[model samples]
Target: MNKFRDKLSTRNTAETGVRYEWYALQRCAATYYREFEKPKIIWGNLATRASFTYDEKDHFFINAPACMLPTSSKFILGVLNSNLISYFLKSICAERQGGFIEQKPVYISQVPIKKPTLSEEEKIIKLVNKILLLNKRINEIGDKKTSESARIEQEINKNDEQIDEIVYNLYGLNKKEIAIIKDSLMK
Candidate 1:
């Protein structure tokens, strides 16, 4: 890989022929993550809503237009996917047409995270894991129109609501702030 590294951007490689051994990736992130697997949160860079997802596989080669959170914490996933975080991101992130917000890392990083106690964090992780399992089952079921899929989705929604409540309480948000969070999502 070292021999081919300099050749990549040089005129020599263009003439001699390309070596497929080189990792086709960004200059910095490529070399480091090649040998390691760490859980990361992947979220759509441009989406109609907050869609922060936990990267269970821990494969670092996520494609373009997604923001990466450099942590494996399911508790963080629970907080990120909550309505409160979604509302927070939407308020600050740049909005494009079609209601999609530009969830650039610069903006995503600004979303505050309030650390909960170990037990509370564990509770959130459990809920997040439940949602992950439900999501997995839905994927296994494949067809979205099936009763099984619907049931799993309903459970996921319930889990999401629970996470949101937990996050709201953790942040000590007022009813008025909660109302604003809820209302901003409406339109």
Candidate 2:
């Protein structure tokens, strides 16, 4: 914890425009968030460039800001990890000189969040939960490679694909649009 504290600066983050003390508030504790390196390459390289978990021990994230939501983390994570959101982000976010999209607070706050119906929410949450579970298993599996490891990997892949499908449906993207997204992601 001392190592994390030592890196703190006197200045507030330009993107967030809030002082570090704000994060100390109780409301900010249960947060999970991710960061994107650049705007331009976000859609081109990865569908979602987000961190999976937060260090609850520290109670705050440094360098990378945590996102707080009234809804389930899995629901938000599913959207953040989707290619559809990537396309949305690229269309609106500011591009950095390094040809990357700056996923700062100001830009990310502008993302068009769809108010999913209860059934939609349930579907997304279920897929995200499965993905998280498989990811946990994969992380826990060190050098011990068993048939189980492969099975976990397969489940992860399948869940990821399902999440993509759900995201596409949520955004009402047709096959052609999804195809374009797929083609762009391939590049």
Candidate 3:
């Protein structure tokens, strides 16, 4: 065990550009949240659906599911928020009376991800960024312009649909599989 510990690499991480030893005392603590770069994805420990979002803050998470994914890309955000992954997670997570699902780190680790090519990743990031901007604009507009807010929401919806399509293509899911996922979501 000592030999293995000695062999552990102490290096910088691409995700945050922060260096740390494999067995750092801080990382081994009960909180389990490690140092992550800003603009990283964060989601609740429990959710009825895939509810992941990006935050530009350095935080010590409390009451949050812990997962160490070295993702600092908006493409990852797009994939997580897509209907495909949502459907996959909903099917696997334990359900409660009010449709609450226990989206613990254990199940999250089991998610099947197809690493995108450079071009594909860029495309997804572009679309996801557009959706993010539209959402921000909606929030900024507030109730001042209900019509403008509605228009921005429609734009967001369109981008979300595009994202789902892109995700489906990424996984090579056929018509039947897509239909099944769509049906499950409607239920």
Candidate 4:
């Protein structure tokens, strides 16, 4: 009987990928928390350490929201939001799909719901607009930084050439001396 049970459990365990497990967990967490009268609690899964390729037709792809957290951190958050029962169920499903189980179940429990009131929903829209503005600002800043860096680099190169010319004129160093000095200074 023990042998049978062990075989059954092992068979059950080989079923789902981390991607599916994470998708299910995210859906469940979102649904569960959205119903709360207070704040709407949001949970997310940790980012995958390894990359997996997916067919675009198989999944919905949106330009990730500016407010969304990075993938690695999101996975940890998902683990925190998940319930033990839900986690176990997901594990069983994953195993059945030939996916490996986590050594320890990781999930978040009982996060306070923070559902926004109607007025609050309006505020959230406004916040999203702000996020858009912030993204634009970030791009502009990055462009400026790149331009400044390039300008500085050009100036430095010009200055170096001038210094090399001066040194060669003053010391009458040979081509090899000049080349060695320039290479040593650059390094």
Candidate 5:
């Protein structure tokens, strides 16, 4: 990839004859360099259609848009990945074929990210940390079906449920509202 680094330096690559002038590759590179001082949340364009796919990496987003937040908090990702956010996206996004919705910059930028209370923020950060740890464990374990792996998987599931419930409460959703959200996602 180093060889191709200069490809986007200009509108076109002279060596490979590849053109990137059409896309904002140079702009992306500039943002990437600037984001190191203040990291941002990286997520897929189709995040709402699928799961709330996101990463905390300090890398350049090529075709994806990064949320340039003041703090590089993973709790924001925790909130974005919650079931409540997914339901909210589904409701607002325009439907495409195959039942997939385009989670473009326009739609994503409008997502209402609630500012949690101090206590709520702390709890959310803790839960997100645990979730990240369990996910790391699962990756480390690979496909091996050890008893320990099974236990870890169970714990991960439980933590996920807790996160979902916390997010719902944070959004001030009543039981009936939560039920409606679940029903919508099921379909």
Candidate 6:
């Protein structure tokens, strides 16, 4: 994602470029919200509740959850807004479009922030890392289960083949007879 971010800043603005910017903005908004907001909300909610505007030819957006006000938590709101500005200044400035710009402000809900101390931030970071690690372990276990199931299926198939060979030998059936019997069983 960092590599993509690097590429995004250097790329030319076309249709794909616009799409990339849209995606990057969405991700940046979500990240900023999560990093600053309390009890992190869903990305869909953030996207739906927030919007962008062109400020003096500069594209900017306020990302907030519904039913919140920027005035409600001015400090956190300022932080989030600043983060958005920095992300754009650093990443999205190169993708700015030409004409057809509007100066109206895009009203999105204000993000709510729980003013956490440094210790709280550290705790949150540790918790988030633990959750991520657990999720990764769960994914690995799921993959291993899938692989084991496939291995068992293959073993069963081999056992069936051995059983069929034993039955053919017991019945004194020739290769052609065994083939006919196998075809009939398949049908």
lDDT at 129, model 4: 38
Writing each residue's lDDT as its tens digit, candidate 6 over 19-83 gives: 44523544434323333344322221222112221112222336443232222232232233322
On TM-score, the leading prediction is: 1
- Per-residue lDDT of model 4, residues 1-187, tens digit only: 5545544444322333112332122333333322333322132232211111112122232333111222322222222222322333343322312333222223222222234345534443443334334444555667566665565556544543443343354345678766664454332
Summed backbone clashes in each candidate are: 0, 6, 0, 28, 0, 1
Ranking by TM-score: 1, 3, 5, 2, 6, 4
lDDT of 1 at 150: 87
lDDT of 4: 0.34
lDDT of candidate 1 at residue 176, scale 0 to 100: 95
Better of 2 and 4 by lDDT: 2
Residue runs of model 4 more than 4 Å from their true location after superposition = 1-14, 17-110, 143-187
Tens-digit lDDT track of model 5 for 1-187: 5566555456535544545544443443432355544555555555434354334565544444443343467778778777888887898888777877777667767778888988778887788788778888988999999998999989977877788898898889999999998888888
Backbone clashes counted, model 4 = 28
Return the TM-score for each candidate structure. 0.81, 0.61, 0.75, 0.23, 0.71, 0.23
Task: Give one digit per residue, the lDDT tens place, for model 1 in 27-141.
Answer: 4453455333667788878988888887757555555676677788888888888889888888899989998889998998898889798877988999999998898898888
Global local distance difference test of model 2: 0.61
> Candidate 3's C-alpha lDDT?
0.78
Estimate candidate 1's alpha-carbon lDDT, on a 0 to 1 scale: 0.80
lDDT against the true structure, each candidate? 0.80, 0.61, 0.78, 0.34, 0.70, 0.37
Indicate the residue-level lDDT of 85 in model 1.
84
Error of 1 at 81 (Å): 0.8
lDDT-based ranking: 1, 3, 5, 2, 6, 4
Question: Per the 3 Å backbone cut-off, how many clashing residue pairs does candidate 5 have?
Answer: 0
Against the true structure, candidate 1 reaches a TM-score of 0.81
Top candidate by lDDT: 1
lDDT for residue 185 in candidate 2, whole number 0-100: 60
For residues 69-175, write the lDDT of model 2, one tens digit per residue.
32335677777768876676767666655445656556556767687888888898898778767777788996688899989888877887888898788889999
Model 5 residue runs over 4 Å out of place are: 1-28, 36-38, 47-57, 62-71, 143-147
